[model samples]
Target: MSRFLPLTIRFADGGSMVVSSIADAKKALNGVWKDKEAPDYLAATRLVDDAVAGTCRPAVAFAAFKKAAAQQGLLKPADPSPALTMLDDLWSRKGKGPPG
Candidate 1:
């Protein structure tokens, strides 16, 4: 098998896609300059590379991927994380009673 594995992301609509490498991710970011003039581009590339290399958290890289995909109109708005949703629910009821 090829040593390089593609990074995959699944959407709530049952749709999914893969990014094969830093170059692929950069291509998805339309209008991104391919040189040092674009620090965001470089940073994102490094993040994806590190994640694929197992040096960074997959969640972190996936978050970056999601942002790029959304910008490219390939992804829908992301729902809040379960933990954040639970926290919001708790705060909304803080002045009332314990959660039942």
Candidate 2:
């Protein structure tokens, strides 16, 4: 399957992993995760599996996997993209009249 936007997960032992596809998420959920029955974990498992089997969009599965990682305290916040940061700077200065 095609790749989704990458999601980084931080391990308690200070290692980090990036998951960018439904297959990667499936492997992480089924092989690496210890708690097999958490609600978010189950949901992500189903979504990722479904994505692999062509039952849902890869984006939906990837998003679910990211949410599960966040719920489990394994999600790593992405670094701000330079282009997005510049846009944010411009937006923050909005409604402030012309530049001096």
Candidate 3:
């Protein structure tokens, strides 16, 4: 009933980071915060906002997400897409395949 998420983090100051999900990492890096110091999420959100505003580069924000994923040690390795399951079922054709 539970799922595991892979994530990572990267820091500009060479610090460490942690997160639970890709969305969580993104939010941690980029979401707003009341504290001016800006936690990882807030900082990331700011970077993404600047990129969206055309004030910063897209790579900057993208790297932030990657870094966050790394720091959290949650990055998932390359795996086949879930859609492959459907393809397998279709190919097997227990009922849907061409009639003999």
Candidate 4:
């Protein structure tokens, strides 16, 4: 079985989704990474590294991708976000509702 990393995403307007593995998270981020700088593959790699190493929260991985893209001047800075909001929210909401 594949080892999974739990991750969450919250939109600027308050919508959110949770992904259970790095693979899924990559797919989700790719949807946004295409319009930015540096190949989406590269950004995805860096984001995975940052997430696994804990230098970046799994959710902030997206922000890091945005930052890297902006540094290359291929895209503008993404909006500010709460650090690791996805993971944080997921953990916080655990066991409080009906099973999925």
TM-score for all predictions? 0.36, 0.70, 0.38, 0.29
State the displacement of the C-alpha of residue 54, model 1, in Å, after optimal TM-score superposition: 2.0
lDDT string for model 2 (1-100, tens) is 4467777877655676778877778877754554668898899989989999999998898898888888888878889999988877886788453355
lDDT of 4 by residue, 1-100 (tens): 5344334554333444555555555555545433444565476567767786777676666555444434443342344466667656776789454335
lDDT of all the models against the reference?
Answer: 0.55, 0.79, 0.52, 0.53
Better of 2 and 3 by TM-score: 2
* Local accuracy of candidate 3 as per-residue lDDT tens digits, 1-100: 2122433333444553445443444455543223335365456667767766788766676566555444444444545667987776787877666445
Clashing pairs in 4: none
The window of 10 residues in a row where model 1 has the poorest summed lDDT is 29-38
Please tell me which model should have the higher lDDT, number 1 or number 3: 1
| Model 1 misplaced stretches (Cα beyond 4 Å) | 1-42, 76-100
- Report the C-alpha displacement of residue 4, candidate 1, in angstroms: 18
Question: How many Å off is the CA of 87 in candidate 2?
Answer: 6.4
Sorted on TM-score, best first, the list reads: 2, 3, 1, 4
